[model samples]
Target: MQSEKLYSDLKPLLLSLAYHTLGSVTDAEDIVQEVFLTWEEKPPQQVRDVKSYLCRSVHNRCVDFIRSSSRKREAYVGTWLPEPVNTDKFQKNDPLAEMVWKESLSTAGLLLLQQLSATERIVFLLHEVFRYRFDEIAEIVDKSTANCRQIFHRAKKGIGPLPDRNPEIIEKKAAFAERFAEALTTGNIGLLIELLSSDTVLYTDGGGKVKAALRPIKGSEKIIRYFIGIKDEIPAGTRYETSEINGMPGIRLVVGEMIFAVITFHYLRDQLSDLFVVMNPDKLSHFNRMK
Candidate 1:
């Protein structure tokens, strides 16, 4: 009973940590369940902080998972976008949910984090995103406090600055996204071109299960052309709805109650700079099951 209660309390934090760390919802859920079973089997006798202990367990597991899965990711088909999570489904008023929403846990942000070493990624996320103290992070990563601080600094420098999350700016981006979605659905090529940056990039992740661009489509002209060309490919009875994906404004394509695609955007100067389209069934399984 106590174990169940503990798991209930920490599930949100642990899952968030693991998901952002590994960028795979299935893997993250597996790790979380594994950690929970381990905790259940061997209850700590003198743990001072249950949250910290559980977080450390998840972090350690994530690091190991990343190291083991590197080669598989390298060989993955087409562009590999992180699995999209529906932010609207998160538990309202939960601190962990708030943290997930506040930080750069977007698909693009997770892609950026993938560039760092496993340890560096963990350290950076703990200190920068989760606001863990260096001493706390040191214990979690099994490193000295000074070393953790150095690692955090180095990781920060390499990853560059985090994105701006100003409320007004976010509102403007949301409004622009609505217009972008409208233009695409309405086949307003002129409006679509105007909303896209000249050097815009679009990544389609089909995971080899379906048809998608093998390489990123660059330039507004190419992206516009690609979208226009693919209209006929969309299944009959498909509909579109604006949705929140990975804490960003996105569009969902559904056919008879099943989500077939999720399209997320990144805007620069109020124009779409980068767009990510995830049509991979594996990536959408968790999300689809929720609906």
Candidate 2:
């Protein structure tokens, strides 16, 4: 009974930890189920700290999953993107909820994490986001505290400084996105170009299964022209709508009953700096929640 109760209590934490590390809710739940199965099969006789043991188990499983998944992802047809999350499903006041949302939803942060090794990602997340000390993470990863600290430092350098997150600035960016989307759908290329920064960049991920720019479009004129060229090419039944995505305003493309794509806006003050469109059918699954 005691062991069952402990496992029950640890389930949510384990899920959050796995989800953040692997960036897939489906994979995270699978890891947690496997952890509990292992605990039941071989109950430890003298476990000193149940929380620590559970955390270590979940982290190890996530690391292994990432290693195997990375190879499969390499064979994926086109740009591999992180899975989108549904923030409304979790309680707003929960710290673990906030961490899951931030790590999974932050476009720049998620991209940065992709560059780190599995162990480095875990070490960096545990130390930076959860405020876990190097000693604790060292124990979890089976490395020296000094080595863990070095790993965390390397991860930090890879991510660099994140953009500012002031609410007012975010609102202004969202407003600009709304206007930009309107311009695109309405065939106003001049207005769209005026809204973009001189060095604006656009990235589209269609997974090679759909038509997309083979390379990123750079500079204001090129990006604007690309949007103009594609605006009328949208399928006959598709529609576009703007909404808040990853804390900033963006656009979602709906085809019939399904959400087929999401485009996130990155702004430099009031000018559009970058536009990221995720059209990979797999990554857009969560967008269905909006309906």
Candidate 3:
């Protein structure tokens, strides 16, 4: 009973850690279940640091899972993207948890993680997202603390620096988002084109499970054409509702009771620079309740 209670108490931490490491809630839950099963079979007689033990166990399991799953993931057609997370469902008290949620929820951050090697991704998440000490993460990844720090530094350098935003720019992003949605829904391609910069780019990730652009659509004219074309392709009765995604205003597509997609807008100054449309059903699970 005591052991069962302990497992229950650690469940959230385990889930959060695994999810950050694996980028998939389903896989994270599976790893947590495996941990509980292992504990049941061979109970720990003494755990001086229960949290550390569980963290290490979960990290090891994630590494193994990543290694084994890489081949299958590489074969995935179209642009493979990380699963999207809904921030409203997660606990907000812990600073680390909040940061993890923010970083993981952002489309750009998630895309960057997908570009990293497994080791680099894990190191980056632990150090940058979770703020884990180098000494502690070294044990998790079986590296010297200095080596771990170097790995993290290299990873950070590879990803480049984040864009600086001012309050005025943020306000402009919101305003543009509202206007862009109205333009899209009303099929006002000219308005949309005007709002977008000349060098605007759009990326759509459907994971090849659904129909989406295989590559990014570049140029304002081409992007306008693509959005205009989508009006007819969407099923009848489908509706779009605007909402905040990763702290930016975006739209969600719903078909009856089911949420079919999410679109996030990236702004450069007052003009729309990049648009991301995520249409993969698996990726849309987080938006299930949004409708």
- Model 1, residue pairs in steric clash: none
Error of 1 at 288 (Å): 1.3
The regions of model 1 sitting more than 4 angstroms off are 91-96
Give the per-residue lDDT digits (tens) of candidate 2, residues 1-291.
Answer: 476787666776677667667766578778899888888899789877777787898888987888788778787665555555544344354555554445333555666787788788788877876678999888888999999999999988997755565778767776787787778777787788779888988878887867787577899888877876787778777777776565456777788888877887666766888778888776666557545
Misplaced by over 4 Å in model 2 are 1-16, 40-43, 88-105, 236-239, 289-291
Q: Write down the RMSD of all candidates, one decimal each.
A: 1.9, 3.3, 3.4
TM-score of 1: 0.94
Output the better candidate (1/3) by TM-score: 1
Better of 2 and 3 by TM-score: 3
Which candidate achieves the best lDDT against the true structure?
Answer: 1
Q: Residue 224 CA error for candidate 3 (Å)?
A: 1.4
Q: What tens digits encode model 1's per-residue C-alpha lDDT throughout 1-291? A: 488788777787788778888888899999999999998889888888788888889888888888888899989999999999887566354666665556647777888888887788889988888889999988888899999999988888877666676878767877877888788778999899889999999999999999999899999999999999998998988877786677777888899989999988877886889999999999999989876
Find the 10 residues in a row with the least total lDDT in model 3. 88-97
The 10 consecutive residues of candidate 2 with the worst lDDT sum are: 96-105
